[model samples]
Target: MARLNFVLLIAVVFSALYLVRTQYESRRLYVELEKASAQSRKLTTEKERLQVEKRAEATPLKIEKLARDRLQMRTTTPAITQYVEYKTAPAVQKASHE
Candidate 1:
């Protein structure tokens, strides 16, 4: 009878230990999940902030200013504009007339 009681006691202790280990693992996983969610929220807000700044930086005036300053480019004016005349091949011109 004492041997049977000893076996039963060991089984109970093992079961208790397994339950504690399972609960500890569950708590750890919950903590990790919460931390990951917080990180996701932080990254989402940062992405939104960067998107807003990108929109602000991509305006037409900003692009023109950067082009003028960095590339030393100028907008074309009528005074500097040139006209081009195209001379077609005689065979192609004749085909078009026909």
Candidate 2:
């Protein structure tokens, strides 16, 4: 009867230890999930800000300003424009003697 009681005590201690370990793992996972959610919110806000900037830049007036100022491009009068093309000479045939 004493040996049976000792076995029961050991089983109860091991069961308690298992329960503690399981709870610890669950708490750790919960903390990690909270951190990931916070990071996701931060990235979502940044994406929205970038989208607003993109929309502002896509305006036609902004594009024209960038093209004229940065690229130095201007609308040319038809009389100021000229087209030229170069023609290549034909290749000469080589004679081979056997």
Candidate 3:
């Protein structure tokens, strides 16, 4: 009977230790999950902000302004327009001396 009591005490102690370890691991994982979710939310907000700015920059007025200011381009009038065709040259072979 004394031996049985000793064995039961050992079993109970091991069970308690296992439970404590499992609970600690669960808490740690929960905290990590919360942090990852917060980061996802922050990145999603930043993506939305960048999308809004992209739309504004793609407007026709903005395109015209960029072309005129950066490229120094102007719309051509009908009187000054000319069209050119691409010309191809024939290949010539060089004479080699033996």
- List where candidate 2 sits over 4 angstroms from the true fold: 80-98
Q: What would you estimate as the lDDT of candidate 1?
A: 0.97
Tell me the deviation in Å of residue 92 in model 3: 28
| Candidate with best TM-score | 1
Listed in order, each prediction's TM-score against the native is 0.83, 0.73, 0.75
Worst 10 residues of 2 by lDDT: 89-98
- CA deviation > 4 Å runs, candidate 3: 84-98
Each model's lDDT: 0.97, 0.97, 0.98
Query: Going through the candidates in order, what is the number of backbone clashes in each?
Result: 0, 0, 0
User: Tens digit of lDDT per residue, candidate 1, span 1-98?
Assistant: 99999999999999999999999999999999999999999999999999999999999999999999999999999999999999876764445564
TM-score order of candidates, top first: 1, 3, 2
Write down the RMSD of all candidates, one decimal each.
3.8, 3.6, 4.8
lDDT of candidate 2 over 1-98, digit per residue (tens): 99999999999999999999999999999999999999999999999999999999999999999999999988789898998999989989788877
